[model samples]
Target: MEPNGMKCAWFQFLIGFEIMSLGAYFPMKVYVYTHDFEEGGKENPKKIHFARIPVIGECIVLSNNPNWYKVVLVLHTPYMAADADAEVWCVKITGSAARKAAGYSAS
Candidate 1:
């Protein structure tokens, strides 16, 4: 094969490989919360319990916000409900609302 023709073929192969690899990668990010924060619960000092704890790979939202998140980790201390802390983690879903299958409602 001619040198120029070989270079063109290699470039095309690289583009195809990159496109396929994108589906396997996560977006790089560093999150920082604003000074405005909500108390984690309704009562005094926000001691709280979750009625339905989210499992890994579940989608959830924070409060009444429209934003959606995919649950990544949940470390529940069943004894800590009466304490002042709770833990949950999720990856933010940008530009997409929660799926109906994730149990969100229009109302």
Candidate 2:
């Protein structure tokens, strides 16, 4: 009975390993945001809590409107394109440093 239990455990482990090797599981991506113009530059202000979403590609887009300096981050899974599921990250930049990092410009 003890040997059979060990065998069952080993078989389960092998099955899990095979599934993982086949890429059946996908991990979520992480992104950090901070205010650079504050007292600590990069170290002064702590990062704020942000959202988490499934992703295949992640990037930031500069606002097209010249009057607004905003960064739009889109997190999406290409596999779900047929389903049209995507999430957007909205962050406001206050100082020039943060703006520059976010590719935000008045021009």
Best by lDDT: 1
Tens digits of per-residue lDDT for model 2, 1-107: 57888999999999989876653344333233322343354422222223334222233333353322133455454574333234344344445645665588834
Enumerate residue pairs that collide in model 1. none
Quote the RMSD, in angstroms, for model 1.
Answer: 14.1
**Each prediction's TM-score against the native?**
0.37, 0.26
| Per-residue error (Å), model 1, residue 38 | 20
Residue 73 in candidate 1, Cα distance off native in Å: 0.6
- lDDT of residue 99 for candidate 2: 60
**TM-score of candidate 2 to 2 decimals:** 0.26
Best TM-score among the predictions, by candidate number: 1
lDDT of 2: 0.43
